[model samples]
Target chain A: MGQEILAIIVIMTAVTYGARVLPFLLFRNKRISGVLKSFIELVPVALLAALVIPELILTPTNEFTFINPFLLTGICTFIFARRVSNLFLVVLFGMVVYWGFDKII
Target chain B: MRVKGFIYGLRQSVTIGIGYAPVALTFGILSLKSGLNILETGLMSMLVFAGASQFITIQLIGQGATIWVIGITTLIVNLRHILMSFSMIRFFPGISLGKLSLLAQGITDETFVLNSKLLEEIPTPEERSNVALGVNIGAFVSWVFFSFLGAWFGNRLNINFSGFDFALLALFIVLTIGTVNRQNITTYIIAGLLAVIFKIIIPGKIYLLLSVALAAAIGAFLQQKQLKQNKCQGENS
Candidate 1:
């Protein structure tokens, strides 16, 4: 890689690492308030929603749902994953459903 | 009895490693198609280590976007790390700043989930940190390795990666379902709808942060309301 690409990677790493480390550093020894804890507790679900909803449905950019059987794909994946016990198997089932739906549509 | 936290962490994180493989392979293939060399692809996986941000970065780079665009956008997209790390503060008490920083580098979504769930199970701080390091290293190696594999053989391979995209959605579904106990179904429903609405309206990575903030506020509000009601019942009694 050239200096430019290396520089971009470095900058990306720096900012990401800085963000990840900031909370642990700044909030050291401080009491986390109840409201703050509640909010933080809620974050994973909210962020996951923020990510999945957009991508699964009408995404802003280059959405595969355009040509693909978008809703059916999601439904089938959801149902198919439920029957599987293993995480890997669930994901594999979802992918299979995705491909099957894509072909049908 | 033998206690091996690092080995335990590795065993626990093997699932995470497997989960990351398909997506990371797709990332490698995408990066290569986006005109990145094998070195650049591997560097992005090793350094950035963020799934969504790296994907967006590749798309932007392919579009001849500026460094500022990629940098700022990826940083914003990954802002939720602040919340995740904040939640982990009480779990990692009394650790040195340097070690904390090192552990923070290894925290991905999978590791964060694993560490939070297993923190209470592992009593000793030393063991806990060791396991966390194991999870981090395991996932990191898996990601970088698949990325290199994809980049090296991208053009020579004839694979349809469209199905691979479902892995991301499947991950979110599993995570969300894991949280869908009787306690907070309403929160999930409202937050989920709000996220969709927020995305449709805003149509950028910033919407992700906005939606999370708003939905988390809903949770906070519900908690406050319940607390106030408890106080009222106490006063009446």
Candidate 2:
């Protein structure tokens, strides 16, 4: 049992680390081109959106309602992040909004 | 300066770590109740530090999923790190592969935002790398520590941080704010729509990959056309 668990851990570590490190290794010494640079800049924004929307907030039972706590929190974060420019406050606002919703609804 | 950079990095990482602590504790408790011992739970936390995948792994383990499926699922989830790492390369000066390997292991979605902003604001390479080192190491330590705490204590440690899970999403939301300029607004919106569409259609980690691919391709094409137009305008002038 211990051996099996150890094997699983090893495989998990290898794959996770590989995914993280492979891109850096591949582009280690190369001069990134103009097109590649433009594309790379967009990667974070595009990917971050993909991770958040639909995945984080699901419309439960085929209805258009914010089933996830993320809706209010996300809006709060978006507003505070622009206004305050403080991550700590943004998180606090998001948490309060989420906790408040959980209690109320 | 290096020391200062590391200290700053550590401090900022702690800020990010604050958000991760609850989630880590939750995972630990969940894994413990799911039949993992403290040691196994801690090892999973150490080896697979990625959050989403770790959560899925614990869930699948509870259901008696096979090792291959668990492993593949995790890899698929984390494959975004590859895109993230590629994006980060523009900010770094060429360093040796040995050091690069160590640094790359530390890249997470949150830290990518922090690091990208750090590079944009500061021109010092030495300080940037040093701070990044501190941030990653600090986040790594706290994450592992909280996991162990959760495993030993289990669900009894719950303080009802239901929405704290959104901290990462909030951070990502903040991180993505400034990237949308006039030129790229349409492309970003299109990409977001595509991501939603793909999520509805194929429905899995593939949406992450597909949306990122399609968005980048479309954005780059638009960028190319803009560049060519500017050149033609310059020629005509």
Candidate 3:
């Protein structure tokens, strides 16, 4: 049992590190072209949107819902964040909103 | 100056470090309940150091999944890191592979978003690199420490983390709002829509990479065309 768990750990560490380090190794010290540079610049916005939206809308069971607490927290946080740039306050407001919504929903 | 940059990086990571606590604690508790001993749980957090992938791994282990199944799932889930690491290369050019590789290990989603935004505002490459290092190490310590703490107290504490999960999501929301601007607004919206569409159509987590690639491609194409049009109008006038 211990050996099997060890194998799993080793495999996960290898693949996770590989996924992260591959780009750095491949493109090290190379001059980035305009197209690739634009793509790179644009990726964070695109990827963050991709990461956030689905999680907001989908439940753990993969059911789509509009009335999610997390979704409400997100909208509230977005509005609050526009007025206030403090990360801690924005996140705290989000948590309060989420807790409130979770109670009702 | 380097120490200042590192200190600044650590300060920037406070929100992320705070956000990581409950989640990492939850991860540790879950791992303990899933039959992993304290040492194993600590090892997983210390070695893997990726959040979502680690959670997925613990879940898979609970379900009696095969080793290969878990490995593949982790690889797919973490493949997004490749895009992040690639994006970061533009900032740290001419740095050695050894230093860059160390930075690469710290490229989780939270730090990636934070550093990408902060790195651009800072002028010097050296300071940028130092800041990135500080953010990475700070977040790393929080995650590993909290995970081990959770495992250590898993059996003793019965705390519920119901609303705490929203903290990380809130950070993402705030950062995402910061990234939106006139230039990338279209891409951002399209990416969100495509993510929802593809999440339904596709299996596993590959939907993330696909939607990002397609949306960013469209954005880059539009941007280049606009640039060319401006140049042509200048020449004509």
Which candidate has the highest DockQ of all? Answer: 3
Better of 2 and 3 by lDDT: 3
Q: Whose TM-score is higher: candidate 2's or candidate 3's?
A: 3
Candidate 3, B1-237: lDDT as tens digits: 989999999988888898899889889999989889889988999889998888888889999999999999998888888888999998997677888889988998889988888898998878899999999999999999999999999567766646676777888888887888999999999999999988888877778888988898888888888888999999999
Candidate 1 local lDDT, residue B17: 77
Please give the DockQ score of every candidate, comma-separated. 0.53, 0.62, 0.71
In Å, residue B182's CA in model 3 sits off its true spot by 0.7
Better candidate number, 2 or 3, judged by DockQ: 3
Model 3 / residue B29 / CA error / Å: 1.6
Q: Model 2: what is its DockQ?
A: 0.62
**Global lDDT scores for all candidate models:** 0.74, 0.77, 0.87
Question: Candidate 2 residues B22-92, lDDT tens each?
Answer: 88898898888777889999988887788878888888888988889888988888887888888877766
lDDT of 3 at B37: 88
How well is each residue in B191-216 modelled by candidate 1, as lDDT tens digits?
A: 77787776666755667667777887
Q: What would the per-residue lDDT of candidate 3 be over residues A3-105, giving only the tens digit for each residue?
A: 9888999999999999889999898888987667778899989988988999889886677988888888888888899999988788787877888898898
